[model samples]
Target chain A: MDFSSKLLEQAVDEVSQLPGIGKRTALRLVLHLLKQPESQTVQLSEALLNLRKNIKLCENCFNISDTQLCEICANTSRNSEIVCVVEDIRDVMAIENTNQYRGLYHVLGGKISPMDGIGPSQLTIKPLIDKVQAGKVEELIFALSSTLEGDTTNFYIFKQIERLEVKTSTIARGISVGDELEYADEITLGRSITNRIPFENSLKN
Target chain B: MDFSSKLLEQAVDEVSQLPGIGKRTALRLVLHLLKQPESQTVQLSEALLNLRKNIKLCENCFNISDTQLCEICANTSRNSEIVCVVEDIRDVMAIENTNQYRGLYHVLGGKISPMDGIGPSQLTIKPLIDKVQAGKVEELIFALSSTLEGDTTNFYIFKQIERLEVKTSTIARGISVGDELEYADEITLGRSITNRIPFENSLKN
Candidate 1:
């Protein structure tokens, strides 16, 4: 759409570059910013720039952090030997929110997606291999999504450290806790049966 | 959710301040930015800041513009006597998209909603009255939204300039073109019937 203001057009253009926002939504957002006090726009712009300029990445886990090590990696109480491998920080946050996991995390930054031109080299797969090869981590949990890219990345990592003594396991996949088995997909229902644990093991959890 | 990184938390907080974005979506957007090259983040930040800093408002109509006068107000071919008064730039864009109107516009910036602490004084209402008082505009079109706030604003503006010689009209509202009559809301259907125009006028479009 043609804009009377070049500034508005440019703002809309840049905002539309984000993942889910389209031109119309970007225009609406920009216009909303314009209606507010100029200080609001300044605060938003400054916040965005400051975060990009000063943000630090954790040296060990490759997670976005304010220091050399992330909060999880820096904490002494959390089990450093048990690391949960994730595709990104969002997964880390999701797992942390559940409060069931008390181990360190290894954020791969992204998964390997050949269709998107992203390879294992583009991610932190090398650092993860190096970490596992050192025999420091006792158990490495693969907590990536169940998509094709996630599977590909997990398989590639598993192959690299197959010789290592570390016990590697992927997160369980089945019908959600409250979901009915009848409505579940065939693959999920079949997998749930094949991977079923003993009644005592289920009761323990 | 507790963030491993303070910078990530700050960015998420700022991004979540946007109209539709919540914490989870904000975190997702921030992580997506981190995955991309740092230059992408810089570009996004700079675009947002530069637009807010350098933008100009049109002198004639108070619409967002890159020059002293907006495109429509500056165009000599368009009818200066016919002015379309709208609530904001989005309305200007919506009407412009139709390619139906050749008139200029006056953007009020917002409707006068007391619940939102918005009053006529907070808007460009005074400037609009001054523009009409100049006796240059022959007709004024009220193209605000069809809401209580919109109607109140329109009525207020109408009362302010009732003594003027200008002809005033509002955009038509009814069941949309090709929309089923049964599904249309009661108020809209009733208004469509009460304000029915000549059958030939409907065919003219």
Candidate 2:
């Protein structure tokens, strides 16, 4: 109906743009922030501004990173030879939370979705193949979703790696469908990782 | 487990500090923001930063305003003498949404809460009494909560306005609880306004 100030209206508009937030909820939040100490709102603004400015994608895995390389890629104790391929950084976090995988990661950014015009070239496949071609990587684990695009991306990776003679596998898809690897429970995800199936052997006839 | 960058971590921490957000939800939101274009994020940051800097408290009614006097107080058609005293600006918005009330508002900022150490002196009661004593005001509406603090604040306001000989009333408690006026559905809040009871009459019995 009526707003007190342009700034209040602006703030509510911005907050409502966020995922899952509507106009009413945004207004409530803006009012809540108004009641808190000024420093709290200042910190939140600083944090949001800094998040985009300071964060960069890791050169190695394309995951979020403070340095040139992500923490997982830089750690010497991690298994560099067994690389886990994921669709995005969120997947890396989900898998890391399981505490079972000690391997390095390769973020594809996204799967091959022709509808979205995202093909293999749009992904980090060239670097992935290069990493595999370097001769140190013993096994490559496919942890992409079980969607059609994910399946197509998986098939492309499997075909490319077949020429190298390296062990290749895909995380089990019996418990998953569509593009929801980002929100799967830890137990189901952990189980999928543990029960990975050999793509080459499964397809051999 | 592992974060992409320190800025991302800091952003997540700041987002989680909001009223109902937690760490996981904060991460999800941060990732969502990250996926958005830089222009969108910049707009959000600008909105948040300008919230306090651009908005001012209306001098006349204590409602938020971009100018010295709020629109409601400046309106010639509105009944300035029939001030609707409310807890905050949200109540003002609620009333304005109905398109029924044409009276000005008096924002108390908050009610008297002894446990939180808030007292009558901390509220806008002094100015309200002054307005009533100025002899222009004919009726004062108490739109505070139904909670103990709201009742106490109402009693304190009633005493202050008693000597002014101006009629005083409170919105019906049947519609809302203390601090919950912000969430009352429009119909209920409007009904409470229409069914207001005289504070002086209630005290007489």
Which candidate leads the pack in DockQ?
1
Worst 10 residues of 1 chain B by lDDT: B28-37
Where does the lowest 10-residue lDDT sum fall in candidate 1 chain A?
A34-43
RMSD of 1: 1.6
Query: iRMS of every model, one decimal?
Result: 1.4, 1.6
Q: Can you tell me which runs of candidate 2 are displaced by over 4 Å?
A: A111-122, A145-156, A159-164, A172-205, B1-4, B115-117, B173-205
How far is each candidate from the true structure, as Cα RMSD in Å?
1.6, 7.7
Q: What lDDT tens digits, residue by residue, belong to model 1 across residues B111-179?
A: 989999999998999988888899988999999998999999999999999999899999988889999
Docking quality tier of model 2: medium
User: TM-score of each candidate?
Assistant: 0.95, 0.79
DockQ for all models: 0.71, 0.58
lDDT of 1 by residue, A12-90 (tens): 9988988999999899888777766778778777777788778888999988888888778889999899999998777
Positional deviation of A59 in candidate 2, in angstroms?
0.9
